[model samples]
Target: MENGILARRRRELITGAVVLAALAVLPLPIADVYTRNLIIITLLFAGLAQAWNILGGYCGQISLGHALYFGAGAYVATLLFVNAGFPPLIGMFVGGAVGGLLALLVGWPCFRLSGHYYAIATVVVGEIGYLLFLNWDYVGGATGVYVPFKGDSWLALQFKTQKLPYHYVTLAFAAAAWFAAWLIEGSRWGFAWRAVRDDVVAARSLGVRVFASKMAAAAISGFFTGLGGAIFAQYVGYIDPESVLGGQFSILIALPAVLGGVGTLWGPVVGAAVLMPVSELSRSYLGGSGRGFDLMLYGALIVVVALARPQGLVSLLGRRRERARAA
Candidate 1:
């Protein structure tokens, strides 16, 4: 029985690795600017979604405020680079550490609560963070801080005139996040998390330390998001309250995870691959000077998807497959 199970898992791993390798090489013959740009955007959001999944999906701790971590990473890296003359490459680690510490600080209190209480706590945390960054003068107050354009400084994380480098970097992060999720899903920590998620009381009865597990998840989740945020800031060459760190930023991370299928390893990746392109198209067609078209489209889509398939895209597909096999 064990051998059979191991064989099946090995086959699945090989197949997935092959698919990912193909995707990594797909850009070798790239010619279209728009297509390359779209891929980059997809990978960035996908990475964010996977990072959020660590806490929201796997641990059943729904955080609507993950942007707090992302924004912190962006601001820290940009500030260190701009003011302290620290290069962005090294600043990435600093940003991740700050985000992880904040996660532990917040998670300790909030994890004591359950269900909606926990959810609401996340909202409050995000709101306070947004307000604080908006008012802080050292980080540019409400105006924002900008990174000097280094045409080709590898140490500073700037590349000579090309989106390809940024695209690859973002893809690498997305891959790392996915692998991390897989590791967590298979480890003893993952088992404890699932037990606690299903029933905290039962988990506690079985000797699971719920608070410690949640804090661990938060720390890991925040680290990935912060790292992604640092990369995003460098890619954009700017950081502002509204742009890098906002409730909307958190929403973007959560949406893909929810839509794709929370708790599943690859769900966020699939969700982002589907959601972001449609969003970009909506923005291109309808977003402009104060136009609300993209917002309308997104709102409608979320509503329809929620009502029609609350279990998410992955669940819906699985049901169809089961039905077909039954037939």
Candidate 2:
């Protein structure tokens, strides 16, 4: 047993090392700016999906309103930077806190209902936030606010030249998010969340505080999603309701988790890595021909994956490993 445990640890460490090494130099090989930009975008999406996974994946609570948290973070940082002259660096954390607070508000009423009812409630709450932002002129209304160009400065979260800084920042956060997930998987909270996931009634019978566990998961999940939003705002230097919030962003953010494997730690990252590049390619190729092509392709892929491999793309690796062991 000891030898087996050591071997697994050895394998995990090596796998982690290799992945980090590859991501470290990921941009060096890609000469095309469009492709590089697509990669950067993928990193951001990976973070968002991973954040969502904390609640949706582990807790088995499918939230279709994650865009609210994302937009909250973006708007918070932008409002502070633009109106209060506060550095976005500071505003990002505040935005994350706001996301957490909002999650508590949404989860308080919604957690009472499970499954699809919970999801529907989330969608409603998300739309409410979107409409409020759309009509509120203080936040630029439907037009949205833009981050000022104050030259390249880390404090301002602005970069004038290469996109390397942005990539590193995202990579760091993605790593941190992944690390958090990893820790949670081993912690008591993680066990409670998983218990609730497997059987909520049984978990409650076991003395688990089901509501509190769900609420904690939601708040933490929202906090990270909000951070992803703030990072995106800084990187793009612009924001709008259509671009930053709504069901589309929610779907896009969740796509990776759905495609990769919702409950698995590295699923979102792998899914985003695969999906983003393909979607970008479709956009590049079919963009001029007509509209909705990209959306159609994404929809088709999701349906096919659901039908053919309900366990998700990551299951393929597990199956291969099982086969190897049998062989």
Candidate 3:
């Protein structure tokens, strides 16, 4: 069993490396700005979903208020850049730290609840955060913060004419998130989280530190989620309560993971790959009709996917692998 586990880990690492290498070159052939931008959004959400999965999937804590952390990261990084003259490269890390810290703080109280109650608490917390940011004049209030164009510099993560750099940047962020999940999936904490997720009573009886596991998961999830938000703020060159901290943003973050097979390694990446394109295409083509046709189309796709693959699209890959091994 030990050797088998080690082999599986090695294989997963090799597979991840190959996939990253392919993604590195995948965008080079596409010159269309819209297509590249779509890819960037997909990559960003892929990372965010994976980050959420660390807590929601493995730890079985379904949080609906992740936008609080997401917006926190965005606001923190933007504030540092605009007010303190800090490079976003540095500010993003600070934002990630704030996100992780905030997650721990939130989890301290909210973790006392379980199941749907915990999820509801997250939504309430997220709403409170949105309201606070919306009224806080220091964070630019509802007017939002416009990230100034400080010339095209990698240090600042600003690119005026090129979209390829953003693509790679998001890709790297997604890769880092995926890699972190991979590490946790193989670690002692990963097993403990899975135990806690599977059954709290059983996990406790078996000596798992359920509360600590949940808190650790929350911190890690919030950290990457915050990092993703900072990347998004920099990418769009703007940040606002509605844009970053809205209720809808939290749903968007969790949907990919839930639809893609919450507990699996490649679920978020696969879900993001499918979900984001369909969403972008619908918005681009149907949004102009002004009747919410784009939203209808997006919802239809989600319904179909949920109905057809309740175990997530990643299950298809798992099925194929099982078949190959059986043969």
* Reference-based lDDT, each prediction: 0.86, 0.87, 0.94
lDDT, candidate 2, equals: 0.87
Per-residue accuracy of model 1 over 1-327 as CA lDDT, tens digit each: 879646755665675687579779877789787888888878888888998999999899999889899999999988999988899888987898888888888898999889999989998999899999999987898999988985687678897577777777888888888888877877889888888788999998999999999999999999989888898899888889999778988899899999888887768988998889889888888898458888889888878878988887888767985898799
| lDDT value for model 3 | 0.94
Superposed by TM-score, candidate 2 places the C-alpha of residue 120 at a distance from the truth, in angstroms, of 0.4
lDDT of 3 at 127: 98
**Top lDDT hit:** 3
Per-residue lDDT of 292 in model 1: 88
What does candidate 3's lDDT look like per residue over 207-310, in tens digits? 99999999999999999999999999999999999999999999999989988999888999998998999888888888997879998988887888889989
Model 1: residues with Cα > 4 Å off, grouped in runs: 1-8, 288-290, 320-327
What's the true lDDT of residue 207 in model 2?
Answer: 94
For each candidate, what TM-score against the reference? 0.93, 0.95, 0.98
Regions of candidate 2 where Cα sits further than 4 Å from its true position: 1-14
